[model samples]
Target: MDQPQNNPKAYWRENLRYLILLLTLWFLVSFGAGILFKEELNAIKIGGFGLGFWFAQQGAIYVFVVLIFVYVRLMNKLDRKYGYDEEA
Candidate 1:
C-alpha cells in the first residue's frame, strides 16, 4: 500500500539505485574478479586455493547469498521509510 503523501517516484528511484549498486558490486566480484582480474587475484591464496579460483568457484556464490540478505534488509528499511511496511 502507498500513502497519499509519499512520493512514489522518489521511492522507486531509490530502490533502483540500490538495485544498481548491489548488482554492480555483484558483477564486479563475479565477473571482474573471477575472470577479468583473475591473473592478479590468483597471486593471493585462501585455504591454499588461489583467490581467483575461489571466486570463480565459491566466492561468487557466497557473495550472492550475502547480497540476498542485504537486499532483504534494505527493502525492509525502505518499506518502513516509505510507510509501506506491513505489520509483522
Candidate 2:
C-alpha cells in the first residue's frame, strides 16, 4: 500500500510478460505440432497414435491443463514479489 503508482505498473508489466510468454508457448505447441509439423511428428508414435494426431486431438488439451497450473504457480510467485495479499 505504501508503494508508488509506478511500482504497480511494474508489477502489471511483469504479469503481462508472463502471460505473453506462456500463451506463446501454448500456441506454438498446439498449432505448430498439430498443424505445421504434423507429417514430421507423425514419424514418432505414441500409444499407437501419431504424435501429431495426438497433439491435435488430446495433447494440446493436456498441455493447456499443465500450463494452467504453471500459470497459477507463476502468478502466486508474482503476487508474493509484488507484496499482494489475496485477503486484501
Candidate 3:
C-alpha cells in the first residue's frame, strides 16, 4: 500500500524557515549592504563601479539567480525529507 501524500500546507509550513532565511539574505544584500550602507561601502569599487551600486545593480541580480538555484536545491531536499517528492 502507498503512503498518502503529505499535506501541501505541511510541506510549506516545514519549508517556511528556508523562505525566511533566503528573504533575509535578499534583504541584507539589497537593502542593508546596498542602500542603507552605501556611503560606508563606497570605499570599495569594482571595475570603476561603487560597491553599493554594483550590489544594487549587477550584484543583487547575481545573488537572486543564485538564490533561485539554492531554493530549488533546498526544496528538493525538503520534499524528500517530507516524503512529498516524486524522486523518492
> How well does candidate 2 match the true structure in TM-score terms?
0.88
- Considering summed lDDT, which 10 consecutive residues are worst modelled in model 2? 1-10
Q: What number of backbone clashes does candidate 2 have, counting pairs of residues 3 or more apart or in separate chains?
A: 0
- Regions more than 4 Å wrong, model 2: 1-6
Residue 75, candidate 1: how far off, in angstroms? 0.6
For residues 1-88, could you state the per-residue lDDT of candidate 1 as single tens digits?
5543357887898899999999999999999999999989999999998999999999999999999999999999888787678962
Residue 56, model 3: lDDT of: 80
Clashing pairs in 2: none
**What is the C-alpha RMSD, rounded to one decimal, of candidate 1?**
3.1
**Local accuracy of candidate 2 as per-residue lDDT tens digits, 25-65:** 99998999999999999999999989999999998899999
For candidate 3, the lDDT comes to 0.84
Top-scoring candidate (TM-score) = 1
State the TM-score for model 3. 0.83
lDDT of each: 0.90, 0.88, 0.84
Taking the candidates one at a time, how many backbone clashes does each contain?
Answer: 0, 0, 0
All candidates: TM-score: 0.89, 0.88, 0.83
lDDT of 3 at 34: 79
Per-residue alpha-carbon lDDT of candidate 3 for residues 35-63, written as tens digits (9 for 90 to 100): 99888877898899889888887788889
